[model samples]
Target: MFSGLSAFPLTPMNESGIDEAAFVRLIERLADASVDSIGALGSTGSYAYLSRAERARVVKLAVEHAGNVPVIAGIGALRTSDVQALSDDAQKAGASAVLLAPMSYQQLSADEVFGLYETVTRSLSVPLCVYDNPGTTHFEFSSELYGRIAQLPNVRSIKIPGVPANPAAAKAHIESLRALIPSHVTLGVSGDASAAMGLNSGCEAWYSVIGGLFPKTALAITRAAQAGDMKAATRLSERLQPLWALFDQHGGSLRVVAAAAELQGVVEHPCLPLPLKALDGTGRQQLAVLLDELELA
Candidate 1:
């Protein structure tokens, strides 16, 4: 049922801290744009930086603003108990599902991975979405492991990033998920720019960081592609090309999305933690150039 434009929102923060008003306004904008669902506290939300209480509050605000819409809360954590805590808070806040990435501590064997999943699954009271964000967590789950993990009662879906060593292997992994995994579990596609291509290749939804800043264009692209209208899809994708371009020329998803937030006037403070920097003057100017080229500045 998680099939369509999935928006990963940017967690709004100001001098005082998590800006609830800005956060709600951002969600409202996405809602007006007809985004299918929302994934909160993922990389786009700067999950690693937020405290436990702060993260819970953000999830609550997302659910409140989203109303009946499916708000998928992110539960990626270094510690297993922390994942459960996030999941619990998400459920309390009215989230529809919890997206869990693997432990970010160290490299884990397939055997150890399954054990970790089993532990979380046992305590999970809400639906679980496996987040295969290899870029950050360095843990790309194998298809052989997925077939087994998908059998968990709480396991509901997965969001796989497209950055695989062997690109075809990632596609092969997705194909295996379709074939071996149960039919009930949904599979969403990620990797910002090529989301449309993944949808055509059998992914159910397109999870996008660009969606937070430009939901209208993001959903437009997804909807157009879903309807098999390549021309319309191309048009919408072109509108979002600027955001992806910023991502390519900048740091990672947070900096890119934060830059879009600044450019779009969504947040007041887009600062990240130490070692993680926001888009600077030259970077901002470069992004502005891209936006100008797209006529969206």
Candidate 2:
């Protein structure tokens, strides 16, 4: 479940709350494309903004529509107790695994972070993926912290933020982390722009954002890397540099992808939750042009 492409789909929403039909369409799209796993309620799914009940519903819907593909539900919350509760909800909803990031309002020490994982892992029946997303969580994990959390009972995968751009440095970075964790715990790479390089550098999986909406395009790069065709993987990823550029220009991928989903009619015009706006008119115009040029429209 941790290997290959784990596609994180947007939790499409409307004024009425979750757009069930649209969300189902997105799940079925990934399933039809044969993605390795479906990541529900991740950052892309707007998990943080949703209530516990909403997150539970999202995971349930994902598992129900994902067919045989495994569902990895994001169970991140600010409090350890809340995270534990969400973990319970994910297990009850039949999630194959749960992704937990150390989400916090105040900064957390390394010991506190380790304690969070240690406490949550104890009651978890399903495997857990260590979500080291420093960008959103605002808490970084050191190599020692990773080693400690990985020693817990359910730790199965560690989702690192991104790899270095240079191939040799990327390989060395992955190798260093590999040595810290148990051999059974797979290393998955996030950051869509560097996914090809990460995979080609020996990471076992790609926890992807773009893979959620355009599974075929993401799969092309994934398959090339898995097949030992490094050049092919790099070529495919480089072809999408324009899209990657949009992610950078717009601050992050959530808004850009939300805009793309709206443009493609996969969801409503403004799919993001309150307090977050969709791309501006100029950004949308630029995205629309690129989407057509890249045949992603």
Estimate TM-scores for all models.
0.90, 0.98
Best candidate (score: TM-score): 2
Q: Which model scores highest in lDDT?
A: 2
- Candidate 2 Cα misplacement greater than 4 A, ranges: none
Minimum summed lDDT over a 10-residue window in model 1 is located at 162-171
lDDT per prediction? 0.77, 0.93
Q: How accurate is candidate 2 locally (lDDT)?
A: 0.93
Give per-residue lDDT, candidate 2, residue 150.
90
What digit string (tens of lDDT, one per residue) describes model 1 on residues 1-297?
Answer: 378988988887754578788889888877777788888888888788788999999998888888666898887778878877877888888888888888667687888778878988898777888888878888878877788899988898878775342436656656877897899888888887777666656678888887777787677778887898766775666566667666776756678667767776677755454456568788878876776676541
Runs off by more than 4 Å, candidate 1: 14-16, 163-173, 238-242, 295-297
Instruction: lDDT for model 1, please.
Output: 0.77
